[model samples]
Target: MSMYVRVKRQDQTVFLRAEASDTFRTVKVALGDILSLVLDDIKLYGKDKETVLEDEGTLGGFEIGNDDVIFWGQRMDGSTFEPASGN
Candidate 1:
């Protein structure tokens, strides 16, 4: 079954459709396509904004659910942004 996840960055939010088996890399590619961003520069965090979601992991492995909110930010110089919590 397909699910939807909300990817937020600052004031912008994007809803991505995905499956439980979809890898983070796949999601990043989709997000990159939508926002015209470089794949390697995209970084994703879990709901808490502290857990970095690795590219090789699947959504189910991360326990991400339908309607769950994940954070997105850009990677710069091998460092990722500190996302604001409780968005």
Candidate 2:
């Protein structure tokens, strides 16, 4: 069955129609279309901003159900991580 989910990116909110069986890759594709970004560059997180939604796993397997809100963020690369507080 198809379900609705919310995707938050900065100040923009996007409602998406997806199935629990859908993979994160599928969501990335749709988000790319809506957000006008490269499909392979889109990454997703949870409300906590720490739970990464990786590919090769079903949405259901991630325990994501109907009406879930996923936060959109940039994919981490070699230079993405940095120290928050440095002397």
Candidate 3:
């Protein structure tokens, strides 16, 4: 079983799907691929906060479900990517 990770980048949100058996590893790799973040540069946590998983944790242990959102260490700010309109 595989899971999909939805991440927001700039004006778009991208989905990276990988095996549920390899959640953490796959997510780090996907983050690296999509957000240009290296595996070492990524950190993840569930909404519950209790199930905190990091670089060395197993994917199955996380048990990610449908619409289970995860957050990485990528920086997203309006001032950086937003284009300025003529005032």
Candidate 4:
């Protein structure tokens, strides 16, 4: 089974395809050697939600299902506490 993670940033969006068995937690591990952001610094959410700073565990437990997606990036507002959509 293959899964894809779509990483979005202010300047770009990238799709990473990987095996479903890979549990390399954290967006930093998923986007390795690309942009430089620590796991704690990476702000990730679904297409419809937001998460707290130390919430990587729950984020990781949910596998990206077949064709399922994960959205991750640096916060444009300069604060991890801010929402991505600016609502």
Top candidate, metric lDDT: 1
Overall local distance difference test of candidate 3: 0.55
How would you encode candidate 3's per-residue C-alpha lDDT over 12-53 as one tens digit per residue? 455777666665766778778866765665455554533446
lDDT of 1 at 81: 55
Candidate with maximal TM-score: 1
Candidates 1 and 4 compared: the better one by TM-score is 1
What order do you get sorting by lDDT, best first? 1, 2, 3, 4
What does the lDDT come to for candidate 1? 0.87
The alpha-carbon root-mean-square deviation between model 4 and the true structure, to one decimal in Å, is 4.2
Q: Estimate each model's TM-score.
A: 0.88, 0.79, 0.60, 0.54
lDDT of 3 at 60: 60
**Residue 61 CA displacement from its true place in model 2, Å:** 0.8
Instruction: Tell me the TM-score of model 2.
Output: 0.79
Q: For residues 1-87, what per-residue lDDT tens digits would candidate 2 score against the true structure?
A: 999878877667788899999998888888888878776667677656677778777778887889887777654583352111111
**Deviating ranges (above 4 Å) for candidate 3:** 8-12, 49-51, 75-87
Candidate 1 per-residue C-alpha lDDT over 50-75 given as tens digits, one digit per residue, 9 for 90 to 100: 88899998899989989999888787
Q: Lowest-lDDT window of 10 residues in candidate 2?
A: 78-87
lDDT of 4 by residue, 1-87 (tens): 556666554446767776655543544566755666565556665645454323434333564555555555555455644344321
* Cα lDDT over the full model 2: 0.74
